[model samples]
Target: MNAILNSARAELLRLRKWPAVWVTLVAWLLLASLFGYVFNYVAYKTGGSNFASEELGNAQIFAALLPENLPAVLVQGMPMFGGALMMVLGAIAAGNGYAYGSWKTVYTQGPSRSAVTAGSLLALTLFVLGVLLATLALFATYTGLIAATEANTIVWPAFSEVAKSFGAGFLVLEMWMLAGYFLGTVARGPALSVGLGLVWTLVLEMLLRGVGGLLGPVETFTQVLPGTAAGSLVGAIASGDPSAMDTPGVLNVLSGPTAAVSVGIYLVVLALGTMLLIRRRDVA
Candidate 1:
């Protein structure tokens, strides 16, 4: 346990020193800033439109689009800010180990394979979580500034709503990181993992969705994909009011319990499967 903890700490310290990680952090902050300003700008221009997201399972109607509210900003800006970019960030973080031969050094220090894997996974996932935290902070700061300066009403989000948003963001971020970690571990390079995640999420997923729609019934298949699952999970939590999704971008509207279960399954399956595969394969 101590060994694993130490390895996790070491891995985190090492990842913090990564230039790519720093670059990603900067980009994430920029994204949060951009989202905050742009969305608030929309509200600022429109004098705060009353466009609310509708519910999926609750049969609720649309409410107003409140830019001053934290939950509203999270649900509205997440598709633009987090999704694919964060996946690439996760890929870069995990794949860098093999790309730069960092894992080899860690293994040489006599840590057990389980400990090393656990530690690396813990560090990488937590690192992304830190990024998400920073994202929220920056976004909140920007939105607050907008509200204060632009004369928009500062309608605060309920504690439950903020909890849901955090839950959704955390789940989405972790799943993306795990997916990238799996690719990084198996492909053993940054390029393939990063490229594959981008291509898979940005291009292939959309193409498949298009083709699936044409074929009919295959839309169900898209629901099972990691990206879909992540979106669904976030949609459920981020829009806790269910009716909060007037123009929910790519949110699946899956019920909260169902989406939560789907996310859990993806995490557990990928984590266990990756561990098993790495145990048999040569990362070096």
Candidate 2:
């Protein structure tokens, strides 16, 4: 345990020193602040307009919004603001050992091969979480100011609700990150893992969804995919009120419990697969 902790710590320090890390961090902060400001501004400008009310509601609805929802917005929008990018970066971090054929060097360290890999993965995931935390903090400050200026009062979502949503998001992030890292390990190239993730999420997933829609009943088959599971988790967190859904659709099937379970399954399956792959595969 101590070895793992030390390895993870050392890996984290190395990551912190990388130029890419600082670049991504700065970009994330800028984008997050911009998004929060724009969202709040638009909501404020349209405060009197019925258009805003129709979608999110007026001051009355705003007052009723919970504090917990703040985290949901930040996390759910993460994919847009460097969540996927960070995962790709993490994949590269993990595959770095193999990039220069440095596995011998890594394995030469006191830590075991599994320990070194796990430590790198842990450091990257925690860094992503830290980014989330920073964005959430900025969001809270912006949200509080909006509420004050708008003078809206209502039962904001509890901090617990936000935490619950973060937990769900964390699981989803871990599963995706692991998938990328493992792909990098097997493919022996960071680009393959990163490209595959982007293609799978942005292209293949959408194609599958379209095909499922055309096939009707067979859509359930597509639901088993990692992307489907991730969508369910996001849906659960982003749903302000199911009663307010614009239309009844399959999204209704993804209740909180269902989303939580689906994400859990993905994580467990990926974890098991990683263990099996590492145990049998050559380091090179």
Please name the candidate that would achieve the greatest lDDT relative to the true structure.
Answer: 1
Model 1 agreement with the true structure over 1-284: per-residue lDDT tens digits:
98888888988888778787788778767765544345435543554532332122211221222433566456444543466666777677667777888777766766877888888788877876787677667667765665567466776777787777777777777777788778877788789898988788778776777788788677778777776666666666545443334333346646667877887888898789778876777756
TM-score of predicted model 2?
A: 0.81
* Per-residue lDDT of candidate 2, residues 1-284 (tens digit): 77777878988898888887788678867865654345446654766423223555554345323343475555554433344565576567656667877665767656787776677767877886887677777777767776677665534567787787678657666667777676777676787887877787667766877888889766877777766666666667666642112211114346668767876887677656765666567765
lDDT of each: 0.66, 0.63
TM-scores of all predicted structures: 0.83, 0.81
